[model samples]
Target: MVASSLISTNFLFSSPLFPPRSPIRKLTIVSLHKIPTPSSSHVKPHKRSLLPCRPLCPPCLNKLLLTTRNPFSFALDSLLILCTSLALSLSLLVADVDSASAFVVTPQRKLQTDELATVRLFQENTPSVVYITNLAARQDAFTLDVFEVPQGSGSGFVWDKGGNIVTNYHVIRGASDLRVTLADQSTFDAKVVGFDQDKDVAVLHVDAPKDKLRPIPIGVSADLLVGQKVFAIGNPFGLDHTLTTGVISGLRREISSAATGRPIQDVIQTDAAINPGNSGGPLLDSAGSLIGINTAIYSPSGASSGVGFSIPVDTVNGIVDQLVKFGKVTRPILGIKFAPDQSVEQLGVSGVLVLDAPANGPAGKAGLLPTKRDSYGRLILGDIITSVNGKKVTNGSDLYRILDQCHVGDKVIVEVLRGDQKEKIPVVLEPKADES
Candidate 1:
């Protein structure tokens, strides 16, 4: 190592071992010293550098030592700040994306002309719907005479200017009298003109003035599609003049009426809120035409469960036209009591089973055979009818509905199932008594 040169005693010396100064030189060194007195009350700036260290050292050397000792402190603080800023930025970006996705943005050009027409139709048809109240005469046993009591309330609409109001038969069930209240708060006493219990339909004649009757425009239900927009207007739970909107959830549903054992076929199902009092209300298409009658709701709580059922307008029109003209529903029927259409496994048979046939009925007169017992007294399943009028009968309801298209006296071709063979038989249909 090269020896560092030191200035001492006003002389340049290479090392301590190189030379020793005389006493006179040492006294000169003491006189050249500006070292502070140890007992000094104040520390002076001149004393700071004079004691031990070199005054010629660079300032960068001291800075390098400080950084080397606790290097992570400053770096750690900077890293934390940078990480915090990045987290905040990510959070803001996520929030923006979520807000953008929450809404469905539809352009006006996306809607078809037919959609607009449907919306206009619903707007126009909502007003013609009316609320119906059924008042029954409940006789007190002590009094022994009939008097009026509010039995239930439902919905209905004016059929025509002839003062006829049409509604579901179940609407006025067990009621001795009926009344109709129009949208204008006009109340009128209604008389039961005709009722078809099997179809769950009834018509009431309210002798209101001609102007009080605003008939709803009827619509054909054959063209309804699932997810089509529909509206319901009725007095739900006696809350008068309530309007509910929803999509046609389903179609061609078979619903049974409790008032009648027969099934109401081709039922329309919707998501609109149909409650207790909305039973007879009109379900309107987009053009405000009456497409269905809002009748039953699928709810465990007996309220609007968003799943509601309606009587299709096609069924209502056919029944109501007959009821108003004939004082009864003109429902056609196949003249045989076939087994209830169920799975073959459920019926314990490979074909449709004949449970009963009226002796004087069409099937009886056609020589269609009934089931008989064996010699050992074992029961044998009867001849199963599989079709009527050349239409294949899948079940009992199918047969009934197919027969409903025919008049009472019309002849129909019937198909029957025998042991290992299918046979066709001609039966002359007969008029049957009305089952009310």
Candidate 2:
């Protein structure tokens, strides 16, 4: 009877009506009930109890018996265990999600002063920048139809609302036709207005609407200081209106012109990344004012090497004005030819050796003599120009530079060295003859 009662209790513990305790706890309770009773027939039943026990009533015994006979009791226990495990896993996932959401971070944003200024400058000046394309005419071999083919591309800036654009002369040189693309991507056919080959500056005009034109604000390059901030806006590598920032690396630098083979004086040297397609673009000051025109860079691989040169706007302003007025530079001349600098140096001469002076020219009229060969075939040296108006003329370039400062019909005193004697004679300047 006791063994049958223990079996009934085991089944009752596994039923769904009772709480689903662990199998170990259930086994512990069953072992307690099965504690051995003392083998004493004379002892009273209550006094001989091995352990304290709750009396099993008839209703409890009946329920335990019925649970033992049920066949689905084992399946019910397994279902309860699986549901509990699933609930525990879902609760852990929810906790992790909540923790992650509570500690989320967002980045803060701030604007720098220099960066803001650069942005403003680009916005204001980009409209004045333009892209120029050089085109050459090629005729089809079969149809004889001519079409303009792309030769090269570079950058330029609008000079005025009248559609006058300024760029490097080499940018448009040898092109049969030209096109200008504005910042808005609108293109127009450009006609050559004027060009100064010696300065490497060219002016072009397009029939663009006045409202579409934006002229770059002019700045004085003469007062520019080294280390001052500079900006460049150009179509670098055919990429339109690209902005590059740098400081003025040097001043009064000289670069040879690609168009005329003459030295460009007072060039502004910068570290701004000027490349091939940037040739005619404007170099601006920090205040968004046009300071110079990017012309060349010193590089062996035909790329920027951080040594870029710009034609100073101070020189550009005067040249452009003259070009627009006369379609050519009206340079003043002394009407005298000199021996080459190399030849003069070999002769150990310190001054420009006068090779010839036209009989009807200003120098000849002023009684300046030229070198000649005597009847005996011995070379005879004439007057050598030593200075002009007190400025020393060491070579032909110095003489030309001094004459450039004078205008036509201006009277200047010319000092020449004749043998061991120095003479100062006054001569009037004249316009240079057009070789074209």
Best by lDDT: 2
Among all windows of 10 consecutive residues in model 1, the one with the lowest summed lDDT is: 1-10
Q: List the residue pairs that clash in candidate 2.
A: none
Model 2, which residues run further than 4 Å from truth? Answer: 1-109, 138-146, 300-302, 364-367, 371-382
- TM-score for each predicted model, relative to the true structure: 0.67, 0.72
Candidate 1: regions farther than 4 A off: 1-127, 300-303, 342-344, 371-377
Please give, for residues 159-214, the per-residue lDDT of candidate 2 as tens digits. Answer: 99989999999999999999999999999999998898888999999999999999
What would the per-residue lDDT of candidate 1 be over residues 71-159, giving only the tens digit for each residue? 37645654555565556556666776787777757565666896776556645654577888889887789979978989889888888
